[model samples]
Target chain A: MNAFIIADNIISPLGFTSSENFDELKKMHTGVKRLEKSTLSNEPVCAAVIDTNKLDAAFQKLSAKQEYTRLEKMVILSINDCLNQNKNIDISNKKTLFIFSSTKGNVDLLDASLASKFDKKRIYLWETANVIAKHFNNPNQALTVSNACISGVLAIILAKRLLEENKYDTIIVSGADILTHFVVSGFQSFKAISNEVAKPYDVKRDGISLGEGCGTVVVSNNKSLAVTLSASSRAESRDEGQASAIIISGGASSNDANHISGPSRTGDGLLLAIEKTLKESNVKASEVNYISGHGTATLYNDDMESLAITDAQLASVPMNSLKSYFGHTLGAAGVIESIIGIHSMRENTLIGTYNFNELGVTKPINIIKNTQKQEVNNCLKTAAGFGGCNAAVFFQKHR
Target chain B: MVNGTEVYSDSSLPSADFIKSAYKHFQLNYPKFYKMDHLCKLAMVASDLLLKHNPITKKYASEDIAIIIANSASSLEIDTEHQNTISDKNNYFPSPAVFVYTLANILIGEIAIRNSIKGENTFFIFDKFDADFMGSYNNSLLSSNKATCCISGWVEFYENEYEAFLYLVEKEKNELNIEHTSEQLNKLYINQI
Candidate 1:
């Protein structure tokens, strides 16, 4: 009962589609930019924020009758694009489930000035999920995952579990979060936001560069549903005889039980999750060719991840974080990064850590500094977030 | 209260005072209890009561236990407090302590730390308690061997209104002799309410 990625889309500052975002990564273009004084903060900050004009215009083409919040619009566009690519998915059918993941959905509604535009209930994540599901006319109540930064990965894991149970033919996992005064200010309070482009796994790294985006991945137990767009693109460009089926072989989540806001000092929690995921995937450590790290570029996070990788005996595997490209999209990070990992496996290319220049962590782990062509078959995507949460899932290329 | 059966309740006491009184009555020794927000406090208290008599930590391995909780509002109470810390430009002083609790899953983290049960844990948001979904999901976890036992149910705290209905799901039937089904969960949950 394997869950395969049928199609995917990413709506971010880098691009609107997964391919577009991947292309930007290949060219080493970062979406992070400096802000003089955005409404999110009184002081200048650095973040990767989506252009609302572009989003509104793109969403307008869908001809949606009602207005949607920024986060909802991004989610709809991402899911709609993903569904468009995989026409076999009957979104409105009972066999399909919509799972929305976000740490702070419509948190902007907390502010009185922005709260007036929509119903007060829209501030609730469940209400926002209902709006998104109703837009597709999906009769089932869309489930919402709101687990800090790990929400996206957890949602995908839940989808896989549901699919394995044969409860649904298809599951659409849409993870999105928008930059708001609430989040920005809170992160600022934690002193966790970098003032410049994030440098993951680098000595000079300061903190995370917060970003806003939406990523949707449609997964199903049936691999014949639709070939991932990235795989098709690879088939077109390269003379690859047959595209490997991209499947989510396994996933597991755990809590550090150490600290609420900080990662485990021992990295045992994440190591446990990684070990369990690989065991469930039935793949050995040596088989994992690449690692999609949840590198928030924070001093402690990168160090903690390196320790986890080393302890998991995956230190030599080439790993890279997409935070430098899209900043830390929080809930969207796991989904979009895993989608890129799927593309990397299909195309046999690995995107580099955009701003990484040196090894900073105590343990030695292979950190990709530049984009390179390689044989990427199995990718281990990892994420550690607030609430002492850590999740690891594997995306494997099945022949 | 344990599973809607009020262990201690006083209509005259405020919600906060009631929580404190219950904590005192239970003789909970965890000093960290005071630092937790209302949501986390409610969850901690409920979980303590549910597991006090039948400690799962002794019965199962730490990794074999999972916590899956669902609630509406989703830390809006703490989220509002965090927002207030930053909403005012004139006196903007956001504390990491308050900001960290803005996430609903922190409550699960608190529970994990208290019992040191580290396994699959997720926080879900729903408009209301969905017994069918929670029961089926928890059952799937147990059936799939993802977890030998799961601590799952609804824990909602917002605007001083709090309710926590958590029940353990294990393979072996207990003295309760209740089947793990949606109807059974709905009945138990309604009884709590």
Candidate 2:
């Protein structure tokens, strides 16, 4: 019952397709820069906003009848890229399952409809799923999962379970979140967004750079170069397990119940998640070769993650946060970071912690200062979000 | 390893009194349960019945237990409220406190913290009740040994309507007097006899 990720697609600050994004990563280039869009904040810093006109052209070519929001557009674009890579596959005959991961699912529609009252039927969950299903012509069952930051990873885990149970032959797990005034103002109100590009694991780090993007993966029972999704875990404990410690042989989601918008100073929940993930994965703290952290560059998140890794005895593991590269993409961070982790493992090289100049947090973890070539066999990808939710995913090279 | 308990808010009691009685039945302090939102209140009531005892004490570490709650509305009531506040141009900013509760799984987090039972937590959403999905998900967690004890069930809340049913599931060698099949669970909820 080994569920495998056969193909993946991403629309990020780097590029539109997986290969395109990979090309940029290989060149050590990033998609993060100053924010220029008018709909978003006048903040000078941002990352990876998709051009709506180009996205519209792509969507029109797919089908003229398909209407989508900024979030839905990302979903279709990423899913299209994945299906394109697997051209020989027939989606019609298979009982394909669509697992959408997002915190804001066309919530912008709710924002717009609020001005002029729209029917509840037009703005509910089923309607959101229908819009995507009709666009992709997917006749199979569709489900939307909203778990804050862990939404995307949870979708993948649920898809894996469905495939394992023989409920579906193909599970398309897609995650999308867009930059809307509603989302932007929410984070801004919390004082979580950074004025400069996010400096993950750095001493001078201020906060996170809010960004938008989407990532998708087609998972099945079929095995390939991609590693199998061994296990997905979540913390159900009240204290030590609050971080849903990454003690899974593969992955776990932990929460710091200490705050609604901030992390616990002790990083207790995060430490538990990492500990659980390592224990379940049967990989020791010392064996972990690298870490992809939820380096939102926010004063609290970076400091908290570093403390948690050190407490879990993973301080020496070379770690970096891609937020410095792509900013904080919220729900998409889990899958996007997992994809980056997979690529890093494949290349036997770890990406450096961008914008990291000094050690701000009092932790023992070694933040990779520059792109370093090393044999990375085992990697851990971790993310934390609003509601004190944190997730850590473990990846091993397919040997 | 077999136990069952049930608690309901008194229909005649005031809303505050009803919530207090539910908390008392679970042997939890009123303030502890009161700190939670309405969705959490529904889940806490169900979980108390399933566990038959308070598991949120400091004595028990949080990582030993897990919660898998399935729902339909998924914090919609709260979302609607938040949307309303931001709808007006003068008060465009949403309260971060209210915004955080918009996530459905926060109830799981609240329960875990209160009980000090930190294990794997997941929040699944289905359009309607699906016995097959629930059974399979429970079986998957048990078979994988990811959780030694699981608080699993459905808790749906919207407007003034609320319903929650939870069961404590764990692998056992001895057969219990109660029925274990999905059919049996469905019967329990529907019969109410």
Candidate 3:
């Protein structure tokens, strides 16, 4: 509950910077478009994909060798932006650890027949992480978090625990997952992909649109360091001499104990996590100012989230699902969305859902239909994933 | 360290039959056991052995028990199996059953459901066993009141190569027979205990 998110960035299709991505959201601009049939499949599918040319240009600035994969490039670019803003911190220091969270990192490296002579070691997520860490000159071996979609938020919780133990001074938490044939086909097989742009919590909502993105948040225990970061980025990120940050107050994750791919119809797992978060933060449910819902727009996921929100007594809070703008970035969803939520709280403006028009769930809950300006103090970010894993993280704005 | 009971397979027997024998030895009736992939079966069997050593159903509430599994291979074997299913153009069928167990942490879900553990769970992919993480994380969870008892250890399976050393961690030193220290943890992991 003490760690401060000193810096953050979301590099995606909408834009490379958090503000750029947020500006698109303010205009209700979507990154989702029809996937190229020759590249994805014959079936029509809409997704939020990155422009390959822009990535190549950014990668050229970062390194001369074109060794990093598209996913790794995005992750490095995102973290570099955060690290650039915090020039005072020694990024390669031993106390500075990095956690890479992703659903399927480099799963595309595997040959289709399992007989391709591709280096079998490249298939390891840790391998990709080591390459990224070495580029940053980080002394410690990067920790790989590959636990379904909740990996991003879980990394934040892991950082908090380790920081509490005084094991590290800084934790660079990065989450990224690029769309690949393996993932696209897997979701396609599950019949969970949306043919059109996703409509979260809307009656016309069909399914999730797969997305590609990378998000990084710099969490440090020292308060003075944050004051310096805010001072450095006054024009771009904050107001004049306003030294403030969002502290991670509470975090916990639970299993549905019901199914692997499907969420619990009763929303028991999410309710348990939210209850734990509130108990840890020592805040009443009504104290939460905003809710960052992980509405993948899938039928059962959205419905279950609504029930959980109501159970947590947070149904009255304004909420938005960024997935409608950026699509579901798998491992990147939790951190990317949380970073935007932190910025939104600082600006006192919550962006509306990109494509949501109607409420379809049986549980009646408040969904932010239009961008609203209000005083914000604390917010809750929740993500559920393939393993029936549900994570709820609470962050509070520090005065 | 396993308190009073422990189970280990030398990889001489088949994985499926070994798991079946475990269900029979424990006289458990969870029908879902057979449906799990190799990685899940490995974790569930290990947890069954540990729970048989130190019973939790009567002492602690279900929500107080958390599980954390760390592995090196991380569902590689099952991933290959699933990859095989969709590799060929003629047989392009990614069955949800096999696809469900693709993530290593799903084993946590399998163990939690069987034991009715409704607490926090996470999976970490480490190149090798990390004693420091295993000890400190378990202690931190207990200190923060996130979990009363944590079932934490290493689980890895790919092809016929596999190793699992699940340890039961608690706040009370007297609760379990073994000392929950990094040294003791490494000993248990390396078969020194």
Highest DockQ among the candidates is held by which one? Answer: 1
lDDT of 3 by residue, A1-399 (tens): 379888889999999988788778778899999865735444678888899999989879976454777777898899888878777667899999999998778776665543254466767788888888988899998888878989998988888778888989899999999887667777887889888999999988999998989999999999887777666556564344443567898899998888888998989899999999889888999788999999999999999999999988988989989898888999899999998888787767788987889899869889999887777778899999877789999998777
Second chain TM-score for model 2: 0.80
Leading candidate by TM-score: 1
True contacts kept of 3: 0.58
lDDT of 1 by residue, B13-83 (tens): 87877788888988998999999999899888889999996789999999889999999999899999888
- Here, model 1's chain A TM-score works out at 0.98
Per-residue lDDT tens digits for candidate 1, residues A212-286, read: 999999998886775555456655645284457788889999989888999999899999899999999999998
After superposition, candidate 1 runs with Cα above 4 Å error: A228-231, B3-5
Which candidate ranks first by lDDT, i.e. highest? 1
How high is each candidate's TM-score? Answer: 0.98, 0.85, 0.94
Which pairs clash in model 1?
A: none
Return the TM-score for candidate 2, rounded to 2 decimals: 0.85
Ranked candidates, highest DockQ first: 1, 3, 2
